[model samples]
Target: MDWERFARQMATMAHDLLEQDSVVGTLERIVRSATELVHGCDAAGILLMDGGRVRTLAATEPMVDASDRLQERLQEGPCFDAARLRDGERVYRIENMTVLQQRWPAYAPSARELGIGSMMGFLLFTENENLGALNLYSRLPGRFTETSETAAWVLASHAAVALSSARSHAQMTESVATRHVIGEAMGILMAGHHIAEDTAFNMLRRHSQDRNVKLREVAREVVELGALPRPEQPSRQ
Candidate 1:
């Protein structure tokens, strides 16, 4: 592949991913581009890890989905290592998993049985956090080369920064909405009870804690009901 042409294609993809309104849409475009742009990549996917749980954000093929779940269930594979940032490795390229029988044990033989010949994974992360792994799979042995690995790594890096930005934006939006709802509920309390803002907020918090409900839930209830519900009586065991 012409490096110049590839770079131009990547530039366009970067613009699209950044401009995407939703995180899922951005990730789906990224995964699809990997299969089309990366040399020797027969399929592509994104693996996301939250806490200890793993999920596939996007996959170009069902094979990619199966592979991701296999890695998750067995707790092994290049994707897992790259996503988890274990051993401080940002990328993992496997030309042949058969040669890594001892290194991967269960995952190696299992991947071979699934018809995976070679694969690569790169860590998707930003300065503040690690998002996950961007993965590519091939059906032929020794499919990935240094050039392809380098290209995939660059793509993954761009994806990581975009993912981080999108997530931050989403969190900020949710926080703002929550604050708006809480403020509305507080205003309702103040108008009904003639209490100060601080006092109204304190009452809401006490009600939330006493009822073992989320503050947002309590606020929503107040906004809908125009008053807090009576506290539940303790059950006699």
Candidate 2:
């Protein structure tokens, strides 16, 4: 392996990751990088556990999605375990997907049928939390080596940090936007009802609870409609 060339490519990928403006963009870039930088990786994807259900993201090809679905259905696979963060295990590899194994008897044959000859999974994690798993797939047996794993580990490290940053930025942006919209709604209510700011906020909060709606949604209704919607009164018998 050309160590110097690999290092330069990794440097470029790290820069590109941070340049992504959105979480989705960052994920897409990460998967693409896996296919490009990870030796023998023909397909790649990110698998996230949402309430114990698998959510496949940024799949590089149809094979990746198919493999993730197989793992989700069987409830056992390297990627599944990686995303679950079982026992602090950070990496898993399968050099021969065609062979039935005790670790994943159901997944091995199904994955082979899906044209996967080898596989690798790295848990994407930062100091604060575990994000998910970055999965790599190859169609040829024994495609991955120690060098491939090393390169993939480096990529996963950068990917985790980039993913966390993107999510944080997105959340911060959404929070700021929500506050601005809610403030506008409060101003509208204060003027329409001749109430103080605190009263307006309390009215919004109460309406949100009474209507079984989010506070942001309730505030948005006030802003869009120019006044808060009147609560429905009980009908006379």
- Using lDDT as the measure, the top candidate is 2
Displacement of residue 14 (Cα, Å) in model 2 is 1.1
* Model 2: lDDT of residue 150: 95
Each candidate's root-mean-square deviation in Å?
Answer: 2.2, 2.1
Candidate 1, residue 166: how far the Cα is off, in Å:
0.5
Task: Report the number of the highest-TM-score candidate.
Answer: 2
Instruction: State the weakest 10-residue window (summed lDDT) of model 2.
Output: 124-133
List model 1 lDDT by residue over 1-237, tens digit each.
699999999899899888988888888888988987889999999988765578898898898999888988898888988888889989887788777566567887788888899999888863334348899999988989999998898888788878887878888989999999999999999999999999999999999888889998899999999988777788999
207-237, model 2: which lDDT tens digit per residue?
A: 9999999999998889889999888899999
What does candidate 1 score on TM?
0.90
Q: Provide the lDDT at 75 for model 1.
A: 89
Candidate 2 wrong stretches, greater than 4 Å = 126-131, 232-237
Error of 2 at 221 (Å): 0.9
Q: How much is the lDDT of residue 44 in candidate 1?
A: 93
